[model samples]
Target: MSLARFLIVLWVCLVSAALPLNAQQQTEQNQPMQLMDGPMDNMLPIEGQRFRIDADIEEITLLFFREPNSQPLILIKPDGSKWYDSDYPLERVTWYTDPNFDMIKIVDPEPGPWQVAGRVDKQNKAIIVSEVRFEAEPLPKQLFQNERLKVEGTLYNGTTPVSTARFRETVVLDVLFVSSNNPDFDNFGADPTRVAEFSDNGQGHDEQAGDGVFTGRFALDVVPGEYLPTYQLETPLYERSFEDEAVVVEHQPVTIDFQLAEERGADNGIEVSLDEKLVNPSSVAINGSVSYPNGEERRFSVTKIDSFPHVIPLDNLAYGKHLVELTVFATSNQGREFELQFNNLSFISVEPVAEPTAEELAQQARQEAVRKAELERQQREAEEQQLIVNLIIVAAVNVVLIAGAISFVWWRRRSKRLNNDPATAQKNAEKAEQKAQKKAQKKAAKSE
Candidate 1:
């Protein structure tokens, strides 16, 4: 009962772990990409609109949206070259225009200020510049038909995992399988050579979703051959696609012992053995050889062993890397034959160790010193620039303060002159009397 309870608990933990993966996958599939928010960097470049972009971004994706009948988006390169949607070299500059939005994809663009000019009406722009790296883990490359296969993937935006809310909306995952022997297997677009599609969903032989893992099984009844597995993971900030091949073959039921090692100078040998139950000892033979780097080939005599662990003598090898190969042919008592070749096993010869010379050590020290000096120079230059900026700010503030003080003094003197001038005071009194007399005469005329 305790063992059964333990198994039940283990099963429950597995289910619980899988539930979140499924939930996350659903969320990714269902949630609409909130393309307009979260990201603070957006630009609407109009005609003669100049903007500077960071030089570090290796790729730039420009997204433009506007109401219908707005000025068509136009951009001019820094090299005095003009670019509109439909620019040549579909790779460097890609233009996608529809009723929804106008977009462009630029790869390895020159780092500098790029100009934007064109029709501008209620225009919205989004600029996403990032470098993405993808790591794809595929199912076992050697599997028989009907065996379940799994492919897992981890996505990164720049150096960080792509879990940021900023990219969740735009990220998408696609996995495809193609046959390796197709005549036009090199080009998938032209021939549509894909044979199957895998999903992260647990159904259809897949394990779970949203856990950065995708899995799918091939048909049990499918033909045995080499198949290509491909996956594409893309987002607004990042995109990567990879394809590789896997093999399927008939299962073999036999055991072979293979070993290689050197003990001291001449005690080194290669050993291989076939199971007596599956292979008849009289018919089993091993052909082994060693090739050195200098075009010398050393072939061993045919070795036969009815029992396990047959040894082949390997001698007269100089100090270096050597390639060793083994080929085994075994026949059953009933005349069924099996051929197996194991090639390119590298064996390294021992060599005497030597200490670095004093001159070499001195050279290494100089190089390290030069590197440290360069770093110090950069730090000093940065410090000097910061100091210059601070000094300029201080000088500007002083100029402003001095000008303000001079203006205040001038105003105070002007007020004193006006208050102390007797002629000015008399002139003011006479103007008041003249204005009063004119008003009184006008009033009497109106009364009459």
Candidate 2:
């Protein structure tokens, strides 16, 4: 091959080899990013209101020739703005055109459309335009209500009105019954059951004309007392969910009015009963012929039950004061419930009859004494058994010591007889003479 042709072919081959290596390097770079997995993969600035825009034109070749006369006025500016001054190419075939925007830019975008087009290596591509607009309105204020409250107001996007936005309205009633200090209700020697619950029985909502006003009314079940009503507004965006100051309602009917402001907080309607003052009598007895307004008058015989707060019909007492006494006797198995007639009988105290003696005090004392003596006898016997066990242990130890002394004396006499034997004396003398000779040899070796 010719030198120039061979050099060109070698360069082409080198470029081709590098392309695959470059592509492999790119794949390795993307692998680390792929290992990261989680919801972070689909993150956006305004996640709740975000939408994806996908427009792609696949690979195609495109070519353009430079014009000699036009000189490509790359730095031309159509308006006075710096963003429009073109100091770079419109776009490169192999690269992306990034349009990074700042917060202020998004808040007030430049007026006009941005026309964008792209081409592959040598082919012409279609063009598109994107018009940018900004929405700078502040969020509307939240709304709330309490039990039996009138909600009337209009919602606005800004100074401009937003009449078409869909809105949801809900009326919730929370009736709380508070108790007083009575044994039946509270934990500290008080009653927790003394409670009263007021309900919001009436509620209505209406949409007004022209002004975009919304209003609501609630009819509260007001008892003959005072109460506290709280208000709250709960919406998705607002965390505080606006709350209103406590509104007090007296014995008479109440009317409240307020204008809806965009920044105003909603009052959470918390229907709390006021701590009530009850007139408690010093003493009340359950002793009467129980008669309901409609049901039968339950009659009690001598055997009738006599439990505290023994609830029976009190003849459906009117809105006034009446006295009734019930008579119950421990002996008379048949108890009697009487509706005392105020006009006929005089009130009298019924003292209980003294119980007759069944056994003498002296007899009870003797019985107790017998039980005491029996307990003492059992304790003494247990102690004596323990003492006997200790005595037995002591006798066993003494016998062991005496047997050991006799064995020691016999061993001493036996040892003395062996030493007195003539044969034993001869053997001992021979051993002593041999030991002396060995000791003398060791001493002589030390001197040498």
Query: lDDT of all the models against the reference?
Result: 0.59, 0.32
**Ten contiguous residues minimizing lDDT sum, candidate 2:** 125-134
lDDT of 2 by residue, 323-375 (tens): 23243212111221111111211121222344435576677788899999999
lDDT of 1 by residue, 249-292 (tens): 22332333334344445535666554465457877676778887
Top candidate by lDDT: 1
**RMSD of every prediction:** 39.0, 30.1
Lowest-lDDT window of 10 residues in candidate 1?
185-194
Q: Using Cα atoms with residue i matched to residue i, what is each candidate's TM-score against the true structure? A: 0.29, 0.26
State candidate 1's TM-score: 0.29
The count of residue-pair clashes in candidate 1 stands at 2
Supply the global lDDT for candidate 1: 0.59
